[model samples]
Target: MGDLEIVKRAIAGDDESFLLVMQVNKEGLYRTAFAFLRNEHDALEAMQEVIYRAYKNMHKVKEPSYVKTWLTRIMMNYCQDQLKKKKRFTINETLNEISIDDGTVQLELQEALKKLSEQEQQLVYMKYFQDTKIKDIAVMENIPEGTVKSRLHKILKTLRQHLTEKGEMDHV
Candidate 1:
């Protein structure tokens, strides 16, 4: 069935249809959550809360074509709330990874991402990691598109400087 069909089903109280939505987007949402929260357990909790909230409020959504955007908006809010509720914890020296290619590069990239502030990390993750477009990210983040571009540009510059200062980049 098409995405619209699924959305209609979900709105009509098909819990399993909601599950399908969650299943399709769960990995992306989890990774996005991880990018912000940085704690696996907290990310999981936030994602769960997001899914639950989405399910409860599915009826409020008026457009069938906006399911993806709507879901991401919910995820972003859940993450922000989670951030506010939890006293932030410092990440340990070591970060985890599951790279298919160069582990060194992956580790460094993860380290660089961790160096970013939470909002910047989320912007980077949504833009590149989840392959989200700037406009969509802006909507999901409830920010202006120009702000998204500026934030992403700033994030890239920061990451480049950080990697260079740390000797990860020689000619950046």
Candidate 2:
């Protein structure tokens, strides 16, 4: 069945349908969670939490077609919450371990991303990392399509400026 039909059945209290939904979206959900959490263990935990929350609030989903977006938003929220809690404890273990040894450009890009607001960061993640469409992002963020496009444009401008200022983009 399609995602919409599966979502409808899941919302109607079909446990198997719910599991199927989770099974189908698990990879995408984990990738999104890992993008935010930057750890396998934390990503797994966030996925579990998102599944629990989505199952509990399945009826709140207004459009079955956007179930993937809804689930992703939930995962993002949970990962953000975990980050906030980690901030309170001043945990350095996870943060220090999530280093990119591939290239300095990636490190510089991450630094630039950190300078963005949470919403901007999310937009970047959804657009680039998850390869989500602008319309889908708009629906997930509860904003208009034009608004999302404008915001994304501004965010890209800001990132480019930040990287240029830091002389990180000179090589490109």
Candidate 3:
């Protein structure tokens, strides 16, 4: 069966379909959580919370075709809330424990991304890290496709300027 049929069943409160949908999307969801939370424990926590949230909100889904995007948005929102809660307690310490898998260039790019506003960061993460289509992002954000493209252009310009100023890049 196609994603649409599975998503419909899931939304219709079929337990098996819900579990199957979660199973198929788990890896991508975890990766997104890890990218935001920056640790294995927190990512797993975020994943569990997302599963609960997805189950609770399954009926709210408007488009079965966008189930993955909808789940990703939930994960992102949960991770962002968790980050906010953490910031309230801890002094904003720099995260130095870069994953061994991440390259130096990736680290530099991450630093640049940190300079962006939360909305901009989400836009970048969805478009680049998750490889979400521009139309999908537009749908998720309730913006026009042209606006998504324009914002991305501006975000890339800002990132290029930041890297250039830091001597991480010789040219934009």
Candidate 4:
């Protein structure tokens, strides 16, 4: 079965097809959850919650072809909400404490990503981290495709500047 057929079946309440959908998308979903939550435990928790949410609301899916995007958007929103609650309870950590100059590119990139607004961060995650297509991102975000492209270009520039300013990377 193809993606659309499988998604349609899943939406139509086929348990096996739903499981297949979850199985196929698990890794990518986990990575997206981890990116936002910043730890394995929280990522796993977020994954479970998102799975529950998606399963409970499967019938709300309007476009079977965009089922993956819909799931991802759920994960993103859930993570964002969790982060908000976490921030409300925790003391704010300074940049020096949150960022480490450990010579790892990934860590540096993550630190730079933190400088972006939540919406900007989501755009980056959808476009780069999840490797979602621009048109798909536009649809998920309910924006024009041209707007998505412009935002991504601006986000990349901001990230590059942030890295350079922090001495994490040389000017390109």
Candidate 5:
């Protein structure tokens, strides 16, 4: 069945249809959750919560085609709330303890990503990590296409500069 059909069925209170929707989008949902939580257990818990919330609020989704984006936005909001709670419970005594030469290129890139604003981080993830198109990202983010492109360009430039200054990327 098409995604729209499945979403319509799910919203109409078909349990199997909702499960199908969850089954189809599980990987994408998990990836987004993991990217934020960075722990397998926490990511799994987040996914469960996202699924429950999606099921409960499935009727609030306006467009069937936008179901994926709607779920993603919910996951992002949930992750952000979890992150805030985590920060409150955790202590960061080694904020300055990271050494430039201590990790691989991927690790350095991850560190640089953490320095970006939440919106920038989400843009980078959607554009690069998830390979989402600019148009799709704009729709998902509820912004104009030109704005998405501009923000992505600026984010890439900032990432490159940050990596280069940290000696993580070779100047070209």
Candidate 6:
């Protein structure tokens, strides 16, 4: 079913519909939250809270079509609150953990991804990691499609430069 139909049923207290909502968007939502929180543990906690909040306050959502944005906004707020509490560094620990199976070049790309600005990182994560369309990202970021395109271009260029400068371009 569509998100709107799912939301309508969820609002009407159909628990299965609510679970369906979770099943459909959980991975995307978790990845988006992870972009902001950076730690899997913290991101999971925030996602759980977001789900609880969304469930409890479903009536407050004004439009059926906006459920995705609404849930994201809730997750964003929860992430911000968690950030304030943590006062974490720019270099999140999650980014530091390297996998041995990935090659050196892949590792370099991972490190380069870690170097991106928070917004740039989010854009890359939303676009590549979560496979979100640029239009949807523009809507979610409250920016124009042109801006999203421009940012992606600039971020990709910068990431390549950073990786090359760091001698990790061979990985790519």
Top model number, TM-score:
3
Pick the winner on lDDT between candidates 3 and 5.
Answer: 3
Please give the distance, in angstroms, between residue 52's alpha carbon in candidate 1 and its true position after superposition.
2.0
Global lDDT of each candidate: 0.75, 0.84, 0.89, 0.85, 0.82, 0.76
lDDT of 3 by residue, 1-172 (tens): 9878999999999989999999999999999998988889999999999999999999999889899989988998898888888889877553665665787677778889878988898899899989999999998789999999999999999999987787744554
Runs in model 2 with CA error above 4 Å? 91-95, 168-172
Q: What is the lDDT of residue 101 in candidate 6?
A: 72
Candidate 2 lDDT tens digits, 98-161: 6767377777787788788877887888888878899898877789999999999999899899
Measured over all alpha carbons after superposition, the RMSD of each candidate to the real structure, in angstroms, is: 4.3, 2.6, 2.7, 3.6, 4.0, 4.4
Alpha-carbon shift of residue 81 in model 3 (angstroms): 1.5
TM-score of each: 0.67, 0.89, 0.90, 0.84, 0.84, 0.68
RMSD of 6: 4.4
The local lDDT score (0 to 100) that residue 49 gets in candidate 1 is: 90
Q: Give the per-residue lDDT of model 6 (tens digit) for 1-172.
A: 6678888998777899988887877877897787677668888888889899988988776666667766766776677677656656544544454446778777778778757766676677667776678887787778999999999999999998987888844445
Instruction: Tell me the TM-score of model 4.
Output: 0.84
Compose the digit string of candidate 4's lDDT tens values, residues 20-109.
999989998998987788678889999899999999999999888888889888999899899889878877643344345545676778
The candidate 1 region of ten consecutive residues with least summed lDDT is: 90-99
Which model scores highest in lDDT?
3
Off by over 4 Å in 3: 92-94, 100-103, 168-172
Whole-model alpha-carbon lDDT for candidate 5: 0.82
Error of 2 at 162 (Å): 2.0
